[model samples]
Target: MEIFNNITIVSSEILQEFEKLSSSVVSDAMDILNLEHGGCLPHTIRPLHNYTKTLVGPITTVYAPEGTSLPVHLAMATHVQNRVLVIATDNYKSCAFLGDIQAHLAALNGCKGIVLDGFVRDKDGSQGLDLPIYCTGTYPKRPGKADLGGINIPITIGNIEIQSGDILIADTDGIVIIPQAYASTILETAKKKDASDAERLKRVKEFNYNFASNIHDFTSILTKDVAEYIKKHM
Candidate 1:
């Protein structure tokens, strides 16, 4: 039942700071560093509710088999406080990997949120809980608690290798994983980007400035007589 090995838990200070950032801003920062993948989950996984608020925390990863819920129970029992629980169900898409009861337990344990690469059910029940749950979709069928999969180990979701201690940012835009190794650097860049974006928005609102028009090359390309040139050459 103890699967919390080789997993690093980020400090509360770092997690608190990251909680302020949106996934879009964090993703923009990741793009700047040429980290193309940047731990972004697939669009298929979405918020269970219309929760517009962002969920940020270190990840407590769970790897479970399809049609089973034992791993989740183990994960909940061993999960650290203020961390996001990430579940990978071997790309399974049939049964609901989690439900309201599990959500309640996670919330009780101070978990920030839940992200599954599988599915979840109990939409109405989950809505009442304080935790935000994200998954590929929902299914009426429930999982049996028989199989015990890995916990706090490296698991792949949306082609991203999510490990324990990695920061997960989820909002309306979707989920993004910030690798523990680059979390500090990424957070610093993301904070700066957020500030810059805010300033840009203010300037645009105040002056209605078309910043894109300042790119002369782009403007020239747009206005280029490419059709005429192609006809003449042909």
Candidate 2:
């Protein structure tokens, strides 16, 4: 079941480290590095379930055509333990590419979750499984086995180039793809940002401020007045 022969596996320690960080924190770190477009996947993509827990894992990319399930099935058959399956459809919105059955198989194969840049069916079943699934939306129409796609290859979802081994951090905010090359550095920076954010939040709570001036740049006139009031009180 080794589909990607050249897959680069990230260590468990790194994955665990990323698990503690939120997508927003990682995105902020990426922005600080001037890699503005690195952390977000697409605005259309969203989590299927209401769970707010974050998903962090290396990705196994799958490029599938519209109304096809062969490539997805093949991806499920591969070594996917603790890995996130990223399915990039060719911007097809007609039929569902993945559903509960496939999600069950993915879970059995040790997949952490799935990010579909398309649609899926069996919403109830998928929700029952309690697996972390992020996608554009859901469709009632099922997919066909056309076998017209590739696995473990570079795919584009929302103009973001996703490759096998790239780390995916997804939560309620959205999905963030941290390229393998920049993962270590980004994680380090994100940790620092998370710490600073925690401290700032504590101060905000203590001072009962609507927003932290140091953390946020307020531009709106009303917000500016509020900031001034808070400053005067402090």
Candidate models: Cα lDDT each: 0.80, 0.82
TM-score for each of the candidates:
0.83, 0.85
In model 1, residue pairs whose N, Cα or C atoms come closer than 3 Å (at least 3 residues apart or on different chains), thus clashing, are none
The numbered model that scores best in TM-score is: 2
Candidate 2 has a TM-score of 0.85
Candidate 1 off by > 4 Å: 208-234
Q: What would the per-residue lDDT of candidate 1 be over residues 61-146, giving only the tens digit for each residue? A: 88887578898887787774777888888779779887888888889988888888788888888886778898888898988887
For candidate 1, which ten residues in a row score worst on lDDT?
A: 215-224
- Give the best candidate by lDDT: 2
